[model samples]
Target: MATYKKRGYKPKKEKVVEEAIEETFDESQSDVAKAFDGLDEAANKSEQWIEKNSRPLFYGLVAIAGLILAYLLYTKFIAEPTEIEASNELAYPRTFFDQAETAAGVKADSLYTLGLEGGDGKYGFLDIASTFSGTKAGNIANYYAGISYLKMKNYKEAIEYLSKFSSDDELLGPTALGAIGDAFADINQPKDALDYYEKAANKQANDFTTPLFLFKAGQTAMQLNEFSKAESLFTQIKDNYATTQIGRNIDKYINSAKYAQ
Candidate 1:
């Protein structure tokens, strides 16, 4: 069995309050902003009008400021408190996983299973994912559960959990895609695996992950007897990533693909 490994699973810092509230900019309020658009005209044309409307403008600015402050207060007081509580609940499984993994052997896999399905008064990642889907902690649980399934060689369940995992992170996003490729490959679905490998390579376009997935994609192409595509993907690593581990060993695969062609 080809086992999948993931980057260290840690609680991703949540910036949801800032990011979520950004969408609340209120396009409907554009009408109010338009009133001040001709401030140049205000400066030159209408001292009397300015004096007459000054009080209302003051009230409008004050009202907008109030709305912003109120939102910040709500996020700080209400949303973040719930976030902290959820994180606290998840800490047990997360810590147990780390300890078991470091111990190595069957214990690690058993702990991963335990973390997915809790017992002994400990909550599992699945519990956190289901009960607190709106929180940042819940999102992290989905990733944990998916990787555990991949390690267990349960491909269908791996796909199910990994498909739901999403992140804009430079590493995790590509990693999730690559893990999906590994799952597909294990099930003799090389074509689907190749697609995900290509997607993972392109997801973040960086040194560490991109070349890794490109290498995996090249291997998958060879499995599908796609010699020409395999040659291209292999040559890409040789040309661009000569210092990477895969790049250093790329010549053997490229030569094989060429010979097959």
Candidate 2:
């Protein structure tokens, strides 16, 4: 028979196991504490930075607000009042332009001269155009100056002022465009004249100005020996604007172009 041996716990090995577990738990606790400390330092630094920079950012915003207020005040108090004053001075020139439109030759010349000289006088049109370019009167002055120059046969000056005169009114817009065509025609640039005349004709597309400019365009094309283009323009006017004077005469223009060809 074999005798059974008794199993016994080893005190030294148990103590060594307990010590290893204690050491591992201590290291884990230390690592957790170190992580928490690092997070606290980062939060403190971020707060410090925000505290240091907030005042400058706030002042910068205030400065921008002040500048905006200053600009608004300047425009309202200074620029707008000056523009109003200048607009009041344009009445004389406008009246003269209306007069010149109805009159002819000598009468027209006198009216235009008055307009031009008055525009340069104490309550001059130039003063309004220069000082109150934001006003309707200023824009009209540019138109008046351009038309006056055109009447004087100063094509270059006419082009300059006409180019400056902008309008949304359909009649005036087409009229200005037509005047440019007239100027180009006067300068003997037939091809350029044809282009501008076509532009004027097509600009607003009304019965009054459209057929008239189209007729002028056709004539210009005929002068430039562009028979096909002249024929096309005259045909368009005849087909689309038959009741108009130019449209009624368009057939004659077509016949002339065909004969020329």
Candidate 3:
């Protein structure tokens, strides 16, 4: 049997399937076009917002740049020069202070005075502390001045200067705190002495300052009739710092504190 067919003819089912595929493609293309239109609209809005805010953004950037420049200039010119000058000025006073530490009687007092008051047109610790307050040298001047006052038995001034000074140095920081405690103890403020002594003991735990301050705190606590705290601190010295000088006698302190309780 011979099947008759027209030219370029397809089956009915094939024609129907092709028509559906073309319609689906048209719908997918329409969806893609809609998505592109939505993206373009959003991009236009972002551009408009950026354009509206461009002047403020530029000024903000300029402000940040100006702050950076100002900081650099200050560090290079004012801060660096002041630090150098303060260090130079500190040398003169430090010499007298060192001499005073080894001297005795009226000579020691005179040297300390010179250290505080300055000579030969050089600035003293006091002057450096006031003039270059933000500099490292100036900050150390406060520590020196405080120690001088402490050695001079000027307890009030010692406390004042020591309180003004701060440091993160393991030795210096704890030493300064302990010095303040010494001042408080000399002034008969047992509570304040105990407080500062404890702070010094805990500031940075080490072999030297830690046991030293702990012993002082224990002694201060004993004075305050805080027998338990005193006993605990003394025990810490006996346990941890047993090789140190104060540690050798810490057992007696612990016994005394325990008996007092």
Against the true structure, whose lDDT is highest?
A: 3
Clashing pairs in 1: none
For model 2 the local lDDT of residue 190 reads 76
* Candidate 3: clashing pairs of residues: none
Backbone clashes under 3 angstroms, per model: 0, 2, 0
Model 1: residue 168 alpha-carbon error in angstroms: 2.3
Query: Model 3, stretches more than 4 Å misplaced?
Result: 1-39
Note the Cα lDDT for every prediction shown.
0.86, 0.84, 0.94
Error of 2 at 244 (Å): 2.5
Ordered from best to worst lDDT, the candidate numbers read: 3, 1, 2
Q: After superposition, how far is residue 33 of candidate 1 from its true place, in Å?
A: 30
User: Which lDDT tens digits does candidate 1 get at residues 1-261?
Assistant: 898657764334545665556656665467557766778567766887778999999999999999999999989997798788779878878876776667666887888888888778877888988877888888888888888888877789888888888887899999999999999999999999999999999899778998999999999999889999999999989999978988898999999999998
Q: What is the TM-score of each candidate against the true structure?
A: 0.70, 0.69, 0.87
Q: Per-candidate RMSD vs. true structure?
A: 27.7, 8.8, 3.5
